[model samples]
Structures are given as C-alpha cells and as structure tokens.
Target chain A: MPMLRIEGLDHRWTGARQDTIRVGALALGAGENLFLHGPSGCGKSTLISAIAGVIDVAEGAVCVAGRDIGSLGSGARDRFRADHIGLVFQMFNLVPWLTGIENVILPCTFSRRRRRRAGNPEAVARRLLGDLGLDPDELGRKTAGDLSVGQQQRVAVARALIGTPDLILADEPTSALDADAKTAFLDVLMRDCKAANTALLFVSHDRGLEGHFDRSVDFRDLDRGGTR
Target chain B: MIGFSLRSLWNRRFVAGLTVFAIALSAALIVGVEKLRDGARDSFVNSASGIDLVVAPRGNPVQILMAAVFGIGGTGTAMSWESFEWLENMPGVAWAVPIQMGDNHRGYPVIGTDVTYFEHVRHSGGQPLQLASGTLFIEGQADGAVLGAEVAARFGHAPGTVIVNAHGSGDVSFHMHDDAPFTVTGVLAPSGTAIDRMVIVSLAGFDAIHAPHGTPDADPLDAAGLAVPPRNTRADHETHEEHREHTGHDHDEGSRAAAGTGEHAHPRGRDPDGHAHAPERLNAVYVGLADRTGVLGLQRAVNDRAAEPLSAVLPAVALTELWGITGTAERALQIMAWTVALASIIGMVVMLSATLESRRREFAILRSVGASPAHVVRLILTEAAVLTGAGLFLGIGIFILAARVAGPVLASRFGVQLDTRGFDARELAVLASLFGAGLAAALVPAIKVYRATLADGLSVRI
Candidate 1:
C-alpha cells in the first residue's frame, strides 16, 4: 500500500450547500515528493488539510500511513495526525510565545511516537535548524512571530522534518521566501524527508518550483478528472 | 502550559487586570461583611459577659442591652430596691448586683451597689476585683464612692478627693445639691467593661441623694445631705468667693488622711448603722454567680417576689437577641457581597469570552502542534484559577490590614472591636465559591476555542 492514498475524495464545509472538492484516486509511494499547484479557491489548502487529517472528509477515504482517516474519531484522528504526520502551513503557524526550539519540540510534547522518532528531540531539532542555516541564537529566539518571513519558512521546514513523520504536508511553505531562500528551504526539506523515507505533499500556487519535486500534479486537472 | 497562559495574560494585561480587580473588589466586600458581622457578635458577647440576668422594668431585650451594657438611654423602669433584695435572696440566686444607672459623674455613669459587690464581682476572665488606688467604701458610709477608671482619670481623683457628682443622666441635670459631695475613697483599675465607665457608689449613697431633702436644690431625706450639684451651677459657684472658701477647707481636711483614726468624726455622735449619714434609696444592684445555670429560674424567682412591676433577663440572651435583630441588615450585606462576587465572575466571563475569540489563532497553532482540545481547556481554566485565587488572597489581605488599622478607632467610636483574626468558615466558603464560579465561567470561552480549533484545522486565523 502507498504511504498515503486518496480514492474518490470529496469534501464540503459543514452547513455549506456547494461541494468544494471532488477528486479522483491518487496514491504516493514512500519517500515520494509531489508538487501540488492550483489557482486560488481550487481547494488546494482543503486537500492538504484532508491529507493531514485536520478536516473531516465529507466523502471517500484519505488514508495516511495506510489507515483511513475517515474511519477514525475526532480524538483518534488528532492523535494519528500528531504521531504520523508533520504539517507546515502558508504561515509558520508557530506558537508566538514559545521560543523557536520550544515551537519545534511542540509536536513531541503531544506525540510520544514523534518524541521517540526524533531521538533526543531537542538535539534533533537543533541539528535540523542548524542545517537549515538557523544559528543557535535564532533557534533560541522567540517563535515565528519574532522571525523574518524567510527565516520563519526555514524554521517551518525544520519543524516539519523533525520527527521524520510518515507524510510531510507542506502548504505553501515557500510562498513567503525569495527564490534563493525558497531554493535553500526546498533543498533542506526534500533532502531531509528523503533521508527519513517520508512522503512529501508540497502545495503551492507557484509553478516555478515544480522541477524540484519527483512528480507535479495540477489540482485543477485532478479535480476535473475526478468530477468527470 | 503555564508559560503559555502567562504570556496570553501578559499580552492582554489591561483586560486581565480589570477582571482581577473585579474579583478582588468582590472578595473585599464579602470578606469585609464577614468581618463586620463576626466583630459585632464578639462585641455583643464581650459586653454582655458575667451578667447572667439583666433585671429591669419590662421592655425590649435589645433595648435593655443597649441601655444596661452600652449605657445608651431608654431607661426601663428600675428594678425596685425591694425587688433587687428579693432577687439576691432567691433560692437559686448566687448574687444579684443591681446596676443603678441614671446618674452621671463627669461623662461616666454612676452605678450604685453594696460593698458586697466588690467581694463577689469578677471580670470576664474571672479576675478578682483589685482597687487601683484607695479602699472600697466603708460598709455603712453612704457618702463614700469608688470612681471608675475613666471618671478617676477625668477628675484626677485619688483616695482622698471629694468629687462633686453630676446628679443626672443626659447632658443636663435638674437639681443642684452643692451642699453634698461623695468622698472618692477608691479608684478602680481599667476593667474593659461597663464598669470602666461607671462611678460605683453605695446603693444607700445613691438613695440618700435622691430622697426629698426639702432644701432648695437638695434632697433633705438623704443621709449626709450630699447631692451632686449641676455642672453649670458649680462652674458659676467655683467662679465665686463662697465656693473657694468651701472647697479650700474641704480640700485641706480630705488631704489629712488620718488613716487609723475615727477620731475626726463629729464630736457629737449620731445614730449607729449611720442611717443619719447614709443615702435612702438604692439605684440598682450587681449580681455575681457561683454557678451560671438556673439564671432564668433565679430571674423568675426574683420577679415573683418583687413588690414593683419589674422584669428579669439574661444579659447574654438580650444581647444575642439584639444581634439577631440586626440579622436582616447583616443578611442584606451578605447578599451584597454575593452580588458583587457574581458581578465580578460575570466580568471575568465576559473578558475571557471576548479574549477567547482572539485566542482562536493560538488555539489553532496549538492544535496544529498537537495539543488536544482538553489541553487548551485546561490552560484557560488555569488562567481563571490564577486570577481568581490572586484576587481572593489580595482581598483578604486588604480586609485584615483595614481591620488592624481601624480596630481601636471603631472600638472607641462604636463600642465594637473589629477583630482581624476572626475569619470564619463562611468567608472561606464564599472565596472558594467565587474561585469556582470564575473557573466555570471560563469554560464557555474554552468550549468556543475548542470548536474554532477543530474548524480552522492547521490554518491559524491570524
């Protein structure tokens, strides 16, 4: 079985009359890196949230690490997401009050599996941040709220790769960075996830970085195929 | 978790501070009311100690307590001397000490009782009577007096000085008996009781002055013909020549303390028992008891044997009833305390509820970082607990400080001591309830955050 599988995945926000998603089957092998690009309102963020088990699936199955999230309760889904998946949002989504190191260790606080996987989580987070060009002082500085946007993206990449999650969901992770910073961040992200055998679902509206990933899937094309 | 909560509060310190102050103000009102209620009870109990039954002419118990214990007026008719004697002789009676009020020496009330009073009367802690200076009245000398601590302090009277008494209650007097004055034979030590504000003369002495003396401004039937002249009249006379001549000779003669000699008495001796030189009618008696039980029985026994229409009461009962009468006002104050607490809790809820919306982004971040909804809920509750607990602690501290700073002033002004150490269980319960309600109030906002987090997914609203 692929590390993540989607079969006839469909969703709409609760209390809304219109369907926001109708996607055909898709599958990703372990350590696969895919670039998912689409126009605004094409449910790119919604598809990433589904893969991360953050949003409830209105129809079809979103299976991460081979377990269907649609079958899990809310609490179990939360725990499953914490243990098996690492997500990076368009913004860093780091707790503002926590230090950079503290924000990086937050996943480990909730998931013993993540903590175990990270192997002395602090040391792992420090090494990852250092490799991503964040100094020890930057790692100890207050969270994304205090960091520049480029720096925040680098921290988010390090955080996503910290626990070697089975699936890495990067939601517009490099949108705020310049081309050079984006290249540096992508190099660190792809290299780290590949080394840990983690599948990557990188979402962005920009197609400039499509060449960096193993496969490129247009969200509009996928939705068209699933609807037809 | 604590760090997070602290940072959240620090970020919105202004709103949080108002919530904290609201809780604190509520705490202050609740704690203050509790202290005042307890203090009033303590004052009533303290003032009513030692006296088992307050024998009086029939009236309200609270009124009787106000008059007898605190010296506030509304004189129930005096328990007649005959009634007092009868009560003292009752089967269950230990000692009946009549408190004869209605006369003033300086600003203090003049109480009349027999010499046996000194032997039997004990103060709150069972401390026996000790004279600060001089001796008790000579058993038969109706003209001798024992000055209360305040009276003694006011007049600078020692064992030998003859103080012209002020012979009535209120701020004015009707009669002036300049011809007679009692020799201050003793000064009592500070007693922290009504006695501290009394000039205790013999019942016979008080009686003598009130008798119909038939002389202008004098009661002729009174032994020794000694009546306290009105203060205004004395000031005028003292400003005149004849007063100087009288006072000069009297001062010298009284200062002569011929301790072992009765040799200075009148060269012509009159009737014995010194009825010729003693007062005719007693004011009231002071009762002392060997055992405190059967007080009601003793009261009944006294009333049945009385010649005049009179009533007997337990001073404690009367004082308790007086305090009970204030129960409605006290309850109203307690309700006010609760209302303040409720309002404060509502304020905290409103603030917390308002802030919860802003906290959605934080909650979403936390959830994306893997915090459970339960964890977020706990963080909110913890913040509430911290704020409410701090307010309660500070409120209690304020109460204790205010009571300590104002204790003596209140005692002197209202005769009620505000004891700082007497916090009751009820107050503790109120504080705990306030804290509990505050925490509960935070739950509304907490649930809202939980729902927002689930809906927002990995996306932080901010």
Candidate 2:
C-alpha cells in the first residue's frame, strides 16, 4: 500500500453550499514527492488540512498507512497523524516562546511512538537541524520568534523530519522568504525528506519550482468543485 | 505539560500576576472574615466569664456588661448593700461578692471588692488572675490596693506607691480623693480582660474613704503626664500641688499615713484610724451557682424574691444577643468579601477566555501534533488551577502576616487574640472551594478551546 492515498474525497466548509475540495484519487508511495500546486485561495491549504487530519473528514476516504482516516474519530485521527506524518506549516508554526531546539523536539512530547522511533528525539532533532546547514548549537538557544525568516523555515523543516515519519506535508514552507532564501529553504526541505525516505506533499501557490518534485498536481486539476 | 503551562504563563506573566493578586485578595477576604468572626466570638465568650449571673438594679443587661465587665461606661443605679446580702443567702447561690465603683485612677476604673474577689473571680475560661508582682491585698490591710497591669503601667504605681482617685468616671471627673489614698501592694499580669483597666481595692478601705465628710475632689486623670512621684514627703506634697494646679481640683491635707501608728486615716478625720468598714451601698454583685441547671430558676428567684427591685442577667445570653444584634453588619462584611471572591473568579475566567482568541493558532498546532481535545482542555484548566491555587496560598500568607502585625493593637483595643495557627478544617475547605471555583471558571474557557476549529493552522489571527 502507498504511504498516502485519497479516493473520492470531498470536503466543505461549514454552512457552505458545495464541497470546497474534491479529489477523485491521489496516491504517493514511499519516498515519492508530489508538489501540490495552486495559487492563493485555490483550496490547496484546505486539501492538505484534510490530509493532515487538522480538520475532521466525513464525505469519503482519506487514508495514511492504508488506514482510512475517515474511519477514525477526531482524537484517534490526531494520534494517527502525530505517529505517521510530519507537518511543516508555511508560516513556521513554531511556538514563539520556545527555543529552536525546544520547538523541534515538541512532537516527541506528544507522540511516544514517534519518540521511540526517533531513538533519542533530542539527538534526532539536532541531527536533522545540523543536516539542514543550521548552527544547531547557536540556533538551538534562540527563541523561534527571534530567528530570521529563512532560518525559521529551516527549523520548521527540521521539526517536521525529526521523527522520520512515513509522510511529510510541507505547506508553502518558503513563502515568507525572499527568492534567494526560498530556493535555499526548498533545498533543505527536499534534502531532509529524501534523507528520511518519506513521501512528500508540498503545497504552494508557486508552480515555477515543480521540477524539484517527482510529480506536480494543480488544485483545479484535483478539485472539480467551482472556485474562483 | 507543566513546562508548557509555565512557559506559556511566563509569556504574559504581568497579566497572570494581576489575576493571581485579584484571586489572592478575594481568598484572603473570605478566610479573614471567617477568622475575625471566630475571633470576635471567642473574645466575647471569654469576656468576664467565671460568674454565672450579674445582679444589678434593673436596666439594660448589655449596658451592664459594657459598664461593669468591659469598664466602658458609668456605673448604673448602685445595688444596695442589703441587696448584696440578700443575693448571697439565696437558695442556689454558691457565692456572691459586691463590687463598688465610682472612682478612677488615670482613666482606669477603681473597683472596690473584698479579698474573696481574688479567690473566686476567673478570666478567659476560668483562668485565675496571676500576679506579676508583689502580693494580693490582705483582708485587713488598710488602704492596700492591687493594680491591674495596665493601670500600674499607666499610672507608674509600683508596689508601695500610693495612687489617689477621682470622684467619677475618669473622662468627666472633676474631683480627686486626696483625702483617700490607695497603696499599690500587687500588680496583676496583663489578663487581656477588663480588669487590666481597673485598680482593685478592699471593700472596707473603699467604705472608709467614701464615708461622711469624704467629699474632697482631685483629678487622677491629670496624672497621665505627671512626673514620677518623689520619694520624700516633701516631693509627694509637690506632686500633689502639681496635680491640683493642672486639674483645678482641691487636694486637702491628704490622707495621712502615720508611719508608726500602724493605722492610716483620712486627715479629713472621716475615720480617725482607717478600719474595715463595709459600705451600705454597692454597685453590682457577681454570683456563681453550685450547678448549671438552676441558672434560670435562680435568675427568676432573684428577680421575684429580692426585697428591693433587682435583675439577674445571664451574662452569656446577653452577650450572645448583643452579638446577634450586631451580626447583620458582620454578615454584610462577609458577603462583601465573597463578592470579591466571585469577582476574582469571573476575572480569572474572563482573562483566560481572552487568551483563547490569541491562542487559537497555538491550539491548532497542538491538535495537529497529536494532542487530544482533552489535552487541549487540560492545558487551559491546569493553568487556571495553578494560578488559583497560588493565589489561595498567597491569601493565607497575607492573612497570617497581617494578623501577626496587628496582634498587639487587636489585643489592646478589642481583647481579641489573633489566631496564629495552622490551617483549620474550615480554612482548608475554603481553599478547596477556591480551587473548585477555579475549575468551574476554567471549564468555560477549556470547552471553548476543545470545540475550537483549527482553521488558521500557521496563521496568527491575534
């Protein structure tokens, strides 16, 4: 079975007249990377929100590790996501009050399975951060809010890849940086995902960087629901 | 979880600190109210305790307590000496002692009673008045007086020192008993009772001075700021002149104590030689019964059977009713304190609820990372509990600290001892209720976080 699979999936915002995101079938195998591309307000983030179980799913099947997430309750879905998936939010979803290393190790505070798989989660976080060309010793002490935008994005990538989950979801993780910093952030993110051999779903409004992924799927191509 | 909660609080510790303070004040108000109420009752319950009934001319019983026991007001219609004897011979009466009053030495009431007062009178739960200096006055000792601790301290009359008296309650008195003098033979310890503000004398000496041709006047209250007494007779005369000059009261050829004669007498010659002469008039009589059961019957018996009109007041009943009459004010204060606690609770809830809007993205991130909805709620509730618990502890600390600081003043003013001790069961219950209130208030915010939709995963809306 593939690491991630979606079949006839549909989602709608509360009180909306029609499904806002619809996908007939989408699949990614181990080590496969799919660049999910669309412009702003194209429902790219909504699709990833469902795939990550950040929102409850009811219409159709959304599966990770061959278990349909729609079958699990909200709480179980959260556990499954934390165990099997790494999420890298675009705006650097690090707790601002914590240090860089503390944010990197936060997932271990929640999922014991991930902590066990990481084999010393702190060492794993440090290794991932160092592999991404960060000065772990220095950046580890700086609060997440104090880091530069590019540095913060790399730390987010390190946080996502710490546990070597089977899947990684990076949602425009470089959008906040300049052109030079964006390429640099992509380089670190791709390298970390390839090193972990995890399937990648990279959501973005930018389509110019499609060559780096194994495949690219546009939002309009996947979601047949009407959207401007 | 604790680390997360603490770090989160450290993020906005100023707001958290203010909230903690509000809660602490509320808790202190509640617990302090309970303490003061108990303290007041304890003080009243022990005030002038030992005697079962007070027999005085019929009037307000509470007023009798104020005047006689608390040394607060003027002595109401004096109980006659005949009535004192009549009360003594009653069927249920174990003992009765007549107390005469009308004079003051430096604002402390001068109490004239026999030596049996020392043997039978009890204070603060049957605790006898232990002497801190010298000896109690012997029955036959002429003009020898026992000073209560405060009176001695205020008037500077140690053993062997003679103190003169004024003719009325010290506040309005214009006369001094320069013709009648009291020799301080003993000083009682600070009993934290009304006796601390009185000078005790033998009944015989009291009558000897107040007998006919004993109308001399001097102001003892003038002695508050007077210089120390001179050792020689000449300096005594000088201080006496100073007293007369300041008070505008006459100091006649004062009571002469002829050293070799073994007899002291008013130089006014009211009594050529001071001798034991019981008076025909008395102010009040305190009675102790043989048993508790006959108290009401004895009260009725004394009221109905006395030849002269007299009333037997159950001291405990009068005092409790007095407290009840004033109890509404206590209840109002208590209610005001609880309102403060309620405000603290609501303030805490409002503060926590405000944080929910700012914490939505954080909550979303937490949920995305595998925290259960229960975990989300727990985080918020745990934070509330920590703050409220700390506030309660701070309240208790302030309560004890304030009491310790105000203990002496409270002792002097109200005779209410500051209860400095460990948390009693009621205090513990108050603490528990505070925590419960915190949880209840936190639940409003907790459920808000739990039911929250994670729409802005990486975006900070607030």
Candidate 3:
C-alpha cells in the first residue's frame, strides 16, 4: 500500500476570491522520495495540507495507509495526522519557548502511537538531533529561539524525523538557509527518510533541489484540468 | 500541557506579572471592603451585648441606642433619677446602671455611672472590662475618674492625672468646669468599642459639677430646679490658678497632684461645710434581665411608664435596625468592589486577546505538531486558571497584610475591629467565583485561537 494516495480531489477557497484546487490522481509508495516543484501560489501548500489531513477537500478521497482520511471526522483526522505524518515548515517551525529536545519530542506528547513506537522518546529525540548534524548535548538545555537559523532548521528536521512517521512533508523548509546550508540540510533529510522507509513529499519553488529526489512533478502538471 | 502553558506565560513574565498584580489588587480590595462592612456591624452589635435594654427619654429607638450605648448624640431629654431607681427595683430586673451625659473631657464623652457599670457591662462577646493599670474608681469618690484606653492615650492620662470637664459634647468647649476637676485613678484596657473613648466617673462627681453653688439644701433629685453655676467666680480663679500650677500646661495636666487635696476635699458629693446631695437626673439607663425571656415585658413596662414618657429598646434590635438603614450603602460599596474585580478579569481577557495576534504563529506551529483545536482551547483555559489562581493566593496575602496593619487603626479611630480570622466561607466563595469568572472570560480568546488554528493550519500568515 502507498503511504499517501489522493484521487479526484477538489477544494474551493471560500471568500472574495473563489479559486479551486483539483488533483486527478497522486500516490507515493512507502520509502519513495518525490519532489513537488511549483511557482509560488500554485496550490502546493493546499495539496500538502490535504495529504496531512489538516484539511478535508470538498470532493474526493485522501487515503493514508489505505484508509481514506477525508471520510474521518475532524478530530479523527487530527489523530491520524499525529500518528502517521510529520510536517516541516519553511522557518520558525519550533515553539520558541521549548528547548530543542523538547520541541523534537513534541509529536509523542500528542500521539500515543508515536510515543509507543519511539521507544523511550527522549533518547530517540536526542539521537535524531545528533543524526541531523546538531549536538544533542549542547541543544538539550537551549531554547529553539536561541539557536542560529541553520541550527533551528536542523532541530526542525530532527523533529520531523522522530517516531519514524509513514510520510514526511517538507514545505519549502530550506528557503531561509544559505545555498551551502540548504544542500547540507537536504542531504541529511533525504538520508534519514530513506533509512526510515518514510515517503518524502518535498514541496518548494526552487528546482535545483529536485536532483536529490527519486521523482519530481510540477504542481501545475498535477492540477491540469482545474477550473482556474 | 499545563507545563507548556506555564513556560509560555513565563516567556512573557513581565506582562503576565502585571496582570497577576492587577488581579491581586482587586482581590484585596474586594475582601478588604467586605471585612470593613462586616466589622462595622459586628462592632456596633457587640458594643450593646449582655445589656438587654437601653431605657432613655421618649424618642427614636435608634437614637436612644446611639445616645445611651454608643455615646453619639444626646437623648434630647433627661429621665429623672427616680425613674432609674424604679427600673432598678422592678420585677425580673437583674441590675440597672444609670448613665449621665452632657459633659466631656476634651472631646471624649464623660460617662457618669457607679461601679455597677463596670461590673455589669460586657462587650466583644461577653468579655468583662479590665483595667489596664489602676483600679476602678470608688463608688462615692467625687474627684476620682477612670479613663478609657483611647482617652488616656489621647490625653496621656494615667493614675493621679487630673482632667477638667467641659459642659458640651463638641470638640472645643469654652464652658470649662474648673471648680470641679476630676483626677484619673485608673485606665481601662482597649475594648474595640465606644467604651474605649469614654472617661467614666461616679454620678456623685457628675452631679457635684452641675449642682448650683452654695445651694446645699436644695432637692438633689429635682431635674427642673438644678442650676448651672456662674462661669466666673473667685473660687473658679483660685482653682484655675492652682490647676495651672499643678498641671504645668493649660491643655493637659499630669500627675503632679498624685496626693493632692482633690482626693479628700469633700468626701462623696459634699461641700467643705458638710452637705449631702446626689444626682438629680439621668440621661439613660442600661438594664439587664434576670431571665432572658423577661426582656420584652420589662421593655414594655419601661416604655409604658405612667409617670414619665420614656422609651426602652433592645440594644441588639436597635443596632441592627440602624445597620439596616445603612445596608444599602454597604451593598453599593460591595458591588463597586466586585465590579473592580470583574474589571480585572476582563483585563486578563484583554491581555490574552492582545497577545493572541502575536502568538498566532506559535499556535500554528503547535497545530503542525498534532495539537488539536481542543488542545488549543485547553491551553488557553489553563493559562487563565494559572493566572487567576496565582492572583488569588497573592491577593489573600495582600489582604492579611492590610488587615494586620489596619486593624488597630480602625479599632481606635472608628471603633471597628476587623475579623482577621483568615478566609471565611464567604471570602472563599468570592475567590472561587473570581476564578470561575476568569476562566469563563478566557474562553473568548480561547475560541478565537481555536478557530485561527483550524483556519491557519501549518501555514501561518505571519
């Protein structure tokens, strides 16, 4: 079974501007790495939200591990997301007041499945931080707000990679990093996803980073027949 | 989650601390105002305890209570001493203490009563009066006086200090009784009642001062024939000069005449020529019933007396009635205090709402980490509970500190003793409602954050 599958999904933004997002078909197998490239405001974030169960589309089926999440209630959808998916935003991903390890282990605080799978969540969080190229000992007591931009991004990556979620969603996460730091961050992120057999749906406007993934698709190609 | 909430608040400790302080101040104000209101009524009620009835000239019952027990205003008429004697010997009457007023030592009222007044009177929950220093004045000791704690402290009077009486109750009186100065022989302990502000002397001394000069043979009990002595006389000048020499200062006199002739000058209401006299009239009388059930009957009999038009009132009932008249004002004050409390809670809501704009990104970050909208609501409610709980505790501390500092001042200045026995049920109820109101008010911001979390998801606008 694929980690995520979407079929004939359609979403209409409510309010003054009535734009629609339509996805005819999409699938990512377990452990696959797919890069989603698009221009800004091309509905890439909307698709990410749909895959993560943060939003239910107005039409169609969003299935994770063969279960259609769009059919679930709002609360159930939230639990499903907590248990099976990890998200990384562009910047300021960590709660600034929480320490680095605390932020990394936060997913387990809400999801019992994640907590049980992590097996000693604190140790797993420290190892994940160490694996992501940040010293766990140094960051253990330091708040995320005190870290450098590169360091904060690494902590965020550690947070996403914890508990070995079925899929990792990266939403232009490296947009704030320098070129060298961006490449370095992508290398570790891809390595961790591959090792965990977690599918990766990396969305960004930048096209240079598509070389690191197994496959790449433009967001415009996915929404071909949408009524703009 | 609560830990998380606390850390978030600590991150903004400066603003959170100010919010808590504002809540604490309102809490203190609310509890303090309640204490004052209750304290005032309790003091009034306790001042008349143990005495069943206050018998005075016919007039308003509350006025009679104020005049007789609280020493407030005059009774407007004086009851004959014979009436007091008659009440003293009435059936079921345990004891009756005659009270005479119309003179003051400086601004403090001088109460003219016998030693029975000290023995029968009880206050502050049936506690008997105790002298802080010297003994109670002798029954017929014309020159002897016992000062209340406040009066003694105000005038610095102690054993053997002689004080002259003034004819009226005003703070300043020019009609000084220089020819009939009374020496302080004792000082009473602080009672937190009107008694604390009185200078008590025997009726013999009170009568001698008002008696007409050289009319030794006049009927002593005749209220209509008693005359005021001329203000200026050779004896007055001689006594004033001796008083000046003895006292050193015109305003206050110390104990220079510790063994002066004032002690033995006219033993028990007599002139040097050897005449006998007694008090002619009385302002009021405090009566105790032998049996509690007979109080109403005795009160009726006193009021229905055929010889004189007099009124008798139950002290407690009269005091409560007086308090009822002022209850509206007290309730207004209480409502104002609670309004201040409500304003503080609203202030907390406004503060939380103001920070919601800045914390939108934070909420979005939590949502991305799998915190549900329900979690967001709980987080906000927990923050409100924590702030109000902390504020409640700090407010209690502030109230206790204020009560400790203000208790004695209120007792001495206004004769109101604060019940500083810690948080009572009513106060706890106030605090509980305050906390409940705080959380309820916080729901406003909580729901706002919940909706924003659902709408913004992982993509916060800012």
Reference-based lDDT, residue A167, model 3: 90
In the range A42-71, model 3's lDDT, one tens digit per residue, is 788888888888887643468887778878
Better of 1 and 3 by lDDT: 3
Clash count, candidate 3 = 0
Candidate 2 chain B: 10-residue stretch with minimal lDDT: B257-266
**Model 3 residue B153 lDDT?**
90
TM-scores for candidates 1 onward, in order: 0.79, 0.84, 0.87
Q: Which candidate achieves the best TM-score against the true structure? A: 3
Shift in Å, residue A130, candidate 3:
2.3
Model 2, B326-362: lDDT tens digits are 7998889888988899999999999999988878877
Which of the two, 1 or 2, has more DockQ? 1
Residue B236 of model 1, lDDT score: 22
Per-residue alpha-carbon lDDT of model 3 for B288-399, expressed as tens digits? 9889899888888988999999999998788778988888998898899889888999989999999998898898888887888999889999999999999988987898
Residue A194's lDDT within candidate 3 is: 90
Shift in Å, residue B153, candidate 1: 11
| Candidate 2 vs candidate 3, lDDT winner | 3
User: What is the Cα-based lDDT of residue A176 in candidate 2?
Assistant: 88
Candidate 1 chain B: 10-residue stretch with minimal lDDT: B259-268
Off by more than 4 A, model 2 = B101-110, B140-184, B192-199, B204-277, B451-462
How big is the positional error of residue B460 in model 2, measured in Å on the Cα after superposition?
A: 5.3
- Cα lDDT tens digits, model 2, A39-96, are 7877777788788876778645688878888888877877888888888877748778
Q: Model 1 segments beyond 4 Å from truth?
A: A58-60, A119-124, A138-144, A224-228, B102-293, B460-462
